[model samples]
Target: MISEATQAVITHYERRHEFRGDVFGAQPYANYGYWARPDLTLEQASEALTDLVAASAGLGQGDKVLDVGCGYGAGAVKFVKRYDVDAVTGIDVTPVRIASGQDYIAEHSVADRITLQEGDATAMSFGDESFHKVVSVECAFHFDTREAFLKEAARVLVPGGTLALTDIIPRRGVDPSAYLTGETTNQSQVCLDMPANAYDADVYADLLRSTGFEAVRIESLLEWTRIPFADALARVAAASEGERAEQISRMATRIRQLIELGEDYVLVTARRS
Candidate 1:
């Protein structure tokens, strides 16, 4: 069973149009697209971010990949299309997302190379060393515990298999307690109240090491990610009106404020050693 917070995250993606327009184009993906540079459009940035994670995974022909928390299957499809992977197996706790992802694979004529199923991150059903690479994008924060998910990821990966992802991290030394009392906290609680497992960058690296991963690389992408994402949200909000627009505006504002306070969006990659 999914936790309440995880359910909320799933529901948010199911109605993603409320915050972001059709980001997946003809495909379906559930994430705030990655914005690597200041000039790229929202869609381009998101795809670029996907490419970044895929590159970090170091995929090659005939490689089997696992996409944990694989949203609507867009990222898996994108991975196979962009890389030479033999197949991508994606899992998410949300049954609706799994169904939608399955539909997307069939609709896109990639069923042979893509599979999506409803599965948990903390305790996956896959056998040990099942994949050559494991990747996720912006979804692990919803897991009951990142440590458990990391252990599961290691268990499913072949020796030296890579694990790559983008994640949200609270800034080092920033007191979350301040968020409880500040006026803006209400607007930013969406980020502030992220799961306790959403640790700072250093702590996240330590967790990966403790989980049997090595060559850990963690990079801060605050300037390129949050700012551009907020800009995209603001642009969308400016073009619309009413409660939905207000909600988007608030989200955009909150992202900007979070960045100002040292909160970060990070890209993390490691190899299962």
Candidate 2:
């Protein structure tokens, strides 16, 4: 079962994105696109991040994938269209967004290749070795603990299958109270609540290895995080007005400070051995 706090976080995303159109509104990819190079546009960078994860997973035609924490099924749709994957099953704790995702998939006419449903990451409803690859993008921190999710991923993936995830991991021992938690410690968490589940890159890799996964690799792609986030904030400031603009500008400044202090977003991959 999804915890009340996590459910709130999912609902928060649903509400924040309710106004966006179907094109790029379902996912935060455009806002925080991965900048492999300086010239890439927000959409290009966002698609590239999906490509990066696909490369890490060695995805191919006829392979089945499980997408845990899939948000509104945007990334899953992209995967089916871009990669030749036979099918992608997406599950999210947020039930409200599932209908929207289903509508989008039907509108795009890719229903045969992608499916989205409301489900928890820690305890998924699937048989053993049900998928060839499992991917979760930038959403694992919301889990009560990554350990339970990783173990469940291992159980759901076939032997020698792959698991890939992108996450915003805090630097070890940093005071998360500075940015993650709100003005008060007991405040409701935001989508990017880092302190709620603090784990550095190394700790993540170690946990993956301990969870019966082998050849675990965790790479910090700070350039992607710092550049794209700054660019998005700049765009937000340019487009918004009043208190919303001010709020986003303040958020940009704090994120830059956190980056300088050693927090990073990373891509992690491993094989179930």
Candidate 3:
């Protein structure tokens, strides 16, 4: 149900991302944000690859942009620097993440061009067709409902605008309950992805079409994460063949695990009709 508590945990972790601590135990992404991750350097390469591949998506200068579930604002920074986007606004339901995102913007000296706020996906306060481009990075799955999220996204997009979403989706009928929510937390209240979610590539295409979007494009390159994960593990293994041989083997195991566990963090881009 994407309860407020689960959102709180996400938000809290982001706040601690800049610090060296652990609050969510040994969760995967619970490590020190991407910046502090042992794999950040390689991960950035992956993001750059995606940026280059999608560079022609037309995020022009002076465009008003909205980033849903901005999460520490890494992608927002990438967009401003790579795409010439003028003004970027990132909104999340978590105050901690909002604060952390804002801090990241200020630290990077992009405060004038970027902003972060706490917002609800089902109901944004922006005017009709307020943004020229809307993008979410691996975060839209947290929206209240797939339909409501798309509807509100459409409401905030102008004619000929675009919505590029990179979110985690379900695989098949696999019960995500064991992986999603945890003790003292219940995200199932709103997480639509279940036992088996095929990243909803087709479903999102259909929803975008129904919500006044045209030229929908769905790319299900789910192995991108594994590429970086394996690369990072290789780096770890390279440090010391004997010392890291076992660790590298574990990393390889983990990369395969990412492929098996998260085969749904897909990228879907839809243009507003």
Best by lDDT: 1
lDDT of 1 by residue, 1-273 (tens): 777656655665555533444633454654566665666766677778788889888977888999998877878888888796999999987676788789887887899999898888888999999999999998777677788899999999999999999887778887644442324222223322554664688899999999999999999877777778888878877977897678778878877876777577888999999
Q: Write candidate 2's Cα lDDT for 57-101 as tens digits.
A: 888888899988877677788788888799999998777667778
Please state the error at residue 163 of candidate 3 in Å.
0.8
Q: What tens digits encode model 3's per-residue C-alpha lDDT throughout 1-273?
A: 455534654554454454312222221122112222343555454465336323535677888889887766766777787777988888877676677677777877888999888887777889998998887765565565656778888888998888886666655554455455432212112332322233346666787799788888876545554455565555655664563366456645644554566455556778888
How far out, in Å, is residue 83 in model 1? 0.3
Pick by TM-score: 1 or 3, better one? 1
Error (Å) of candidate 2 at residue 41 is 2.9
For TM-score, the strongest prediction is 1
lDDT on C-alpha atoms for all candidate structures: 0.78, 0.76, 0.62
Candidate 1 regions off by >4 Å? 15-26, 179-195
Relative to the unseen true structure, what is the C-alpha lDDT of residue 97 in candidate 1, on a scale of 0 to 100? 77
RMSD of each: 3.0, 3.1, 6.6
Query: On lDDT, who's better, 1 or 2?
Result: 1
TM-score of each: 0.89, 0.87, 0.70
